[model samples]
Target: MNIPSLPPPVTRDKNALVLFSGGQDSTTCLAWALTHYNHVETVGFSYGQRHAVELEGRPRILEKLRQFSEKWNRRLGADHIVDLSLISHLSETAMTTEMEIRVMENGLPNTFVPGRNLMFLTAAAMLAYRRDLNTLVGGMCETDFSGYPDCRDDAVKALQVALNIGMDTRLALLTPLMWKNKKETWQMAFDLGGQKLIELIVSETHTCYIGEHNRLHEWGYGCGKCPACLLRKRGFMEYQSEKKPI
Candidate 1:
């Protein structure tokens, strides 16, 4: 798949709160926010995901990120974790349950937790409002992803508008990875913080849906078969190939 050229980085003099999940994409977004914003904070949701191991990796990733540079250490701010376990009660999708990962009759994956991203963004927006952060950053992407309707660009943009109008405040919802494929996402982490960031991501970040973190893979700690793991593995392979001699 041909990934489109990334737009120029958007710098904000104020602050941004990233919707961080301690996965590859969210880790990259946190780095991007630290690089572009004056102050960067992170917010994670505890929605009783089967892969809740990612939650444990959050602080470890953040601490390691602080060591990347003095500037980032200074810019990185407090981290917030929201208790959204209600999602498990509200939905019985594969993400919140132990059901086999398969396609539903409606054509969407059983992994598609209904309104997961929507609730995430809404909660993040509310947190941003309280924290006085004007910008909201997330790793949501339409390219190289599961066919989740919520991850689509249109849905995110509409939610952004709704969020701002409902709150009566101008909040900039930024999806830096909205168009980039997983390969391009790998490149993005490299661009933001180089090899060290990539190493940290591969060693520390968690992306497995089945909560497998003890078994490590070249791309990261995953089962290397789930949709999330497969995507990450494929992207890393492509990224490595691109860096090789022609």
Candidate 2:
């Protein structure tokens, strides 16, 4: 089905609180925020995981994100980075444990941390409410990856309704890549001109929840056997093929 494009700039205020994980989708969402909002700030959660190495890559990702932020900050925005790491102990899932990550066999994958997006978005809305910003951008997608229930559109809309009623604020949960697959997501990031988008995504973000943070190569660190590594490898290859000369 074709969804007609809404009016130009369906947003009310340019201020937004982005749920950044320093990954491809979130990073791409950050780039999208630069083009849409007047003020955008990012919040990254350092959830305890076997692959704590991804957290180590945050500073580098922030440097790049900050650069992107500067361009739009001068025009319609500014950006900031915030840390929220206290909830790692409260969650129970394969992502925060030493247990091996299982493939998606029973609908959702094991790496789907329970209530992650809901909790994150709710937290972000609090910050958004404080700033009186009605726009909130998250990096959750239901395409070609973990089928976490929280990443679905219904969940997002439900949460949005709850958020507004709870705080009496109308916050729009904008997901530019929700309907897109990983292949299209890569291309969007490329067109956004992240300079090293392919490289940045392939080498920077930590998808492997395992403790193998030391592994590095043409496609960053991963166990190479997990669901995430496999999906990423497939996407990277597709992205490369898409860019190659015919």
Instruction: For each candidate, give its TM-score against the true structure.
Output: 0.94, 0.83
Reference-based lDDT, residue 216, model 1: 83
RMSD of 2: 3.7
**lDDT score for residue 10 of model 1:** 47
lDDT score of residue 22 within candidate 1:
93
Among these predictions, the greatest lDDT belongs to: 1
Off by over 4 Å in 2: 1-13, 68-70, 73-87, 103-107, 244-246
Residue by residue across 1-246, what tens digits does model 1's lDDT show? Answer: 232322323444678999999999999999999998889999999999999999999999999999989999999999999999999999998888887898889998899989999999999989988998888898999999899998988888788778866998788888999999999999999999998999999999998888889888889898888899999999999999997453
